[model samples]
Target chain A: MSRSVKKDTLLKVAESLFYEHGFRGVGLKQIINEANVATMTLYNHFSSKENLIEEVLKQREERYWSYLDAHVEMESDSPFILAAEAHGRFLKEESYKGCMFLRAIEDYGEMDNNIEKIARGHKQKLLEYFQQLAHRKGKNNEKDLANQFTLLLEGTTSMTPLIGAEKATEYSIAMARTLVQHTS
Target chain B: MSRSVKKDTLLKVAESLFYEHGFRGVGLKQIINEANVATMTLYNHFSSKENLIEEVLKQREERYWSYLDAHVEMESDSPFILAAEAHGRFLKEESYKGCMFLRAIEDYGEMDNNIEKIARGHKQKLLEYFQQLAHRKGKNNEKDLANQFTLLLEGTTSMTPLIGAEKATEYSIAMARTLVQHTS
Candidate 1:
């Protein structure tokens, strides 16, 4: 089989298991079993379990960031609206367990250089997006405003599920708008 | 040993390991070893690993909520101000790994009924606190305000490290203050 085919299969198996059972709960044997591949085959595709895990994180990141870009465009969406839309998309996901970055941070334990870099990059992009919007609005401290917005965005994500209804996405929109309204 | 002393020792070990590592990362074996007790002794004191975990959650709950209550009673801390002080305490934690609930939730794969209950209970209290605060402030839709406030608190906790900043807490305090000011 080609590398792409093998890699795809591994990602599918790993992502499901990791998401369902958490990174620490699932093990190499289980992944191999679920993927229907021999240990050597699994290792052949990815150098080690950690690398395979990183690939899982990478796939989730790409899927999410691209989705965010599609949602928040320069041509449309006021800063508040754009930020709220991102939350909406996340809530729509059937697999929206929690923040992938949080799960990655939790599962990766001692963060590998690549995983940490990827996580940092994703967060930086979010901050940048919010900061750009604040700058567009002519906030005195765009950076500070952007950072505050990110906190509320994050705070909403966490609070929603715990808030105990399906209103997580909606709650985020309200909170995001409120936070943005303050700075603007 | 007295039941309270025995329980206290177990809670200490559980908190240290759970906070430093994670719930899944720390096993009963390790907890017992750290507590300096034989396996039977561990079983005798706590009904099972799950119960021990509850004790861990309970201890975390008490520590956090006691602080929350203290602020709530300060007479000067309007609902919003009390809420801000609570956020300040959360941010000032020495480790700042993440929210205790998120930490437990992340590792709590295949949720147990009792664990879920404890998690839900802790969240319920927080929301109630928020709601009561909003009510006291005469904020319209006090329930909604509480939901929004809870979301910000939770989101910031998880988002802090992802965004990789110490300012998350500061932003939380400032934003929380703004929320109270505007809502009040």
Candidate 2:
């Protein structure tokens, strides 16, 4: 395989293992063995385990944004409803683990400043994305609305694995509608 | 120390270490070392690391309920607000790691059936607690209201570690008030 393909394969395996078992639980050897790559290949692609985790987080964030963007392209609901449904759909379709970013912070927040920074930055960006959506909806007190929206989304993500994803999604969207209508 | 005192010390030290570092991240050796107890003492009291974790979760749940009960006794707010404020205060006063039960589920869900069961049971009980609070408040749709209340609380818990606990708590209570008023 080409070097790029090898790198992608490594990332795919690493992300899957890390998500299932967490950053600390899964090791570099397991990632390499799963990817069917040599130890040298893993080292060549990422400098350290921390670097690999950082790359995985960055890739995951991009994929999340893409999921939201794809939903916007297909749905014509109001921005608030559209965002909520998009997020809900993402939760249902994904494997329904808790938020990977938050998990990353939980694992590495104290030990690694860089990892925590990336995790916090990802969440902050999501909050800002909600702010933009609320702005597009022309809601009064858009910042406050965005914060509530973020909370609901975070709640939905956290609750999905325990409660079924479908129920969690339904309740989240229903609450989002109530919050939006009450504010309006 | 007395047997009970030794047990309490072990539980306290174990809880703190597990909260700061996850279950997999912190080892039994570290727990015993911190508690100044022997390995045999830990095993004698709890049988295994998993049992130790289960006891810690049970104690934490009791502490959480006591916090809410204390608040209800001291304040005259509606049940919904009382529960929300109590939870908010719990997050603020505690060191504010992510939800320990959910974290347990994440770490041990795949590997340990009993751990996952205990975690899920704890969450279900919290949901029921919310339902009782909603019923007391005479909400028209108490079940749905309770679900929303649980989501907001979960959201607040997840967000508290990222945003300051104060802001997360304030937003949660405000949103809880809106949810209660709307449902009523």
The lDDT per prediction is 0.70, 0.83
Q: Residue-wise lDDT of candidate 1 within A77-175, one digit each (tens)?
A: 465677567756765672545666666665454745576566666778878887788777777898888787777666655654564325766766665
Fnat for candidate 2 (0 to 1): 0.69
Listed per candidate, the RMSD to the true structure in angstroms reads 2.9, 2.6
For model 2, residues B102-168, the per-residue Cα lDDT tens digits are 8888878778568888888988988887777666665567677777778888899899878867888
Give the range where candidate 1 chain A is weakest over 10 consecutive residues by summed lDDT. A157-166
Q: How much is B92 displaced in model 2, in angstroms?
A: 0.8
User: DockQ: which candidate is best?
Assistant: 2
- When candidate 2 is compared with the true two-chain complex, its DockQ is 0.72
lDDT (Cα, tens digit) per residue for candidate 2, span A18-80: 888888889899999999999999999899999999999888888888878877642244676
Error of 1 at B113 (Å): 3.0
Worst 10 residues of 2 chain A by lDDT: A72-81
